[model samples]
Target chain A: MIVADKKPIEEIIESVKEFKKILILGCNECVTVCEAGGKKEVGILASALRMFFLNQGKDVKIDEQTLERQCDHEYLEEIRDVVDQYEAILSLACGVGVQFTAEKYHSTPILPGVNTCFLGATEQRGLWTERCQACGSCILAFTGGICPVSRCAKRLLNGPCGGSSKGKCEISKDVDCAWQLIIDRLKALGKLDEYEKVQPIKNWSTDRAGGPRRVVREDVAL
Target chain B: MLAEMEPPKGVDISVMMENASRVKGEIDAFVVPEMSNAVMRMSALGGALLLQKNGMDTVMQVCCRDRNRLALQADLLAAGASGVKHIMVVTGEDPGFGDHHQAKAVYDLTLLELLDAIEKMENGHDMSGIDLCGSPQFLVGSTVNAGLSAQALESELSEMNQKIKSGVDFFITPPLFDIASIKPFLSCVDLSKTPIIPTVLLLKSLGMARYMARNVKHVHIPDELVRRIQNAPDKARECVNIAAETVHAIKEHGFSGVCISTIGWEDKVPDILKNIS
Candidate 1:
């Protein structure tokens, strides 16, 4: 899932300081699962903002609403009737959702409430680690199910670069050696022979290095 | 003849070679290590140029972790033009391993990809099919792990064979505490003509030895050696003696010359060389 972290209250206050009336919009999808910009978080942020304004002797009107999914147009239409009532919206969604909401709303200032992190999986409730870079070209099949581009510090297609000590990356003890894991997994699977096959230089056009990507299928397209 | 050494502080060659002169005749070429911990110093190629200016042959170590193919190829051609004859290609340590934790690593090309590009350049063309006015020449080398688990040896060798097939002129192994530790790796790979230079690191203290054994990947320090260093009366002297002894053992095993990673203990290299010779 696309992970995001809640913005600090101080930063959020600074962003909306100029506006007295604002809508705190939340997403029920990735931000919800990550607990950043979901319904519960939106409620907490609204209360916090209200308390801040009350303490400052300022009256700020804040409205809270959580969309099923901020990225889709269907869920976004529900906010059109009320969006004009507020000066701005503090979106508690990933970057994609914020942009989508802004595109549809057109004039309302769409403010981000959370920092979008990466495409990752939750190791536990509080801990999330990156798993994929969405590099477009996936080589997990050759790497024993591990993603080198996301996991390897150098993103080396052929590596365990000389700095790996034990099974850890040279950058830190906390990071695992992606190549080491690949070799170990291949060894366990009795496919160690595959480890030596050097992959060609990557054509990064399929990755973010190329540009914003788009996928179109004629069969599904009208 | 390549003496594996760090770049001098501020890249002051005079101060750097002051200690290097102690082993003048012993080392014909010097190999400079790339920056560790993201702490800036003289670049590997820059250090090699300094050494070459001093009348010593040098091998500039290049890593794929930081530079893209364009930068790498540019550096290689620059080194060749400067008369540097050898290159040691390495997949550099992750930047997180260094002090600069936030630096983004640009592993644009893998070790194989870099090596392949070097081979292509040697054959008179750039990676993008741009023909060079003059093809640069280099004796390309790479590093390998000496200590591998029995189960992982085949996989490691496959990587080694790939390096060999990519036109690596020689393979330099990580530091070896015991010759026996590398025998399993050696027996599996055919190194009939290729020279396998075993690295010998000077273990300064029990802590250093233990840290390497427990933390460094693919490096195995024997328990006996660790105990010996732990119990030694004078660790400094014992470390030198052990290094000299290992160099002798490596030579006796019919391996190519030793690459001693002195790690600031270069002052004692002459003694180690004298003792071994």
Candidate 2:
């Protein structure tokens, strides 16, 4: 899932301060799961903004709404009638959702209230860890399912560099050495031989090095 | 025959130059390390160039920790053009180990990929397959961890073989206190084709020895040796004797050569090599 973190309340206040009427928009997708942007968060933000403006003795109208998924056009159209009522939308969604909302409603200003972090999983209730880089090419079969591109400090294909000590990365004791994990997993599965085979120089063109990318699926196109 | 020399942390190279001149006739070449342990310093290329200008042969170490492929290739070209013939490629220590904890590590190319890029440049093409007007050739050397455990030794040997296949001319092992400790590595690699130069690191004190033994990954400092340093009345002299003895033992074991790393005690390098000849 796309993980995100809420922006500081001060920054959110400053961004929406210029507008007299504001809409606090939230996404019910990945942002909701990560606890960054959701229906509950939208209500909390709206109440806070109302109190902030009330304390300043200003007449500001604050409204809250959360779509099923902000990226989808059908769910976004549900707010078409009310979107023009507000001068700006403080979107508590991923960057993708904010941009999609802006594209759908050309006149309204869409401001991101959360920082989209990475494609990751919730390690526990309130903790998230990155798992993939969306590098277009995957090599998990050889590496025992651990993603070096996302995990390793160096992203070394042939690794466990000399800095790996006591199964921890040289960067931090908190971060586990990705190569150590790969080696341990391979050893457990009796597939240590896979590590012996040299992984060739990566063709990075398939990665972000290739620049902004797009996928055109003729079969799935409407 | 190679003695490791660290570049000065700041601009002044007078001390470094003086140390190199002290051991100029005694050692074959000075291996200028590139920010080993991730501590920032003047680049190895700059120090190597200074020594090269002073008519001393140098093995300038290059690591994939700091530079991207373009910068690496550019520096390699600079090294080649400036008459540096030996290049030791290492995947350097991570940035967190050094002073700059927040600096982003740029391992844009892996060890294998960087080696392949060097090979490509030698063949008159860059990594992008663009033709080069002049190709730079180097005697490439890389480090191999001489792991003690059976699993680790197997993995090291496999990586060593891959390094050899990648056109590494020779190999250098991490510091070894006991000669018998490298028996596993010795049995695996045929040192005839690609000579392995074992490092003889100067153990400054018992504390350093204990620290390295406990914290360092591949380095193995024996308990007996640490006790010897602990027992010695003059511990400094004892440390020098231990380093010199390791070099002598390396020669007796029939390894091609030895790399003496003084680890900031550069003045003691002459002392370490004095009895070897």
Per-prediction DockQ, in order? Answer: 0.02, 0.02
**Residue ranges of candidate 1 with Cα displaced over 4 Å:** A1-222
**Candidate 1: fraction of native contacts reproduced:** 0.00
TM-score: which candidate is best?
A: 2
> How well is each residue in B1-277 modelled by candidate 2, as lDDT tens digits?
9999999999998999999999999788899999988899999999999999999999999899899999999999999999999999999887767876545577899999999999999999999999998999999999988755589888878888898889899888888888777777778777776698999999998899889989987677788898999999999999999999999989888888999998899999989988664
- Model 1, residue A218: C-alpha shift (Å): 44
Question: How well is each residue in A1-222 modelled by candidate 2, as lDDT tens digits?
Answer: 999998999999999888999999999999999999999899888888999999999999998899999889999999999988999999998999999999999999999999999999999999999999888889999999999999999899997788988999999999999999999999999999999999977655556644456889999999
**Chain A TM-score vs. truth, each candidate:** 0.97, 0.97
lDDT of 1 at B8: 67
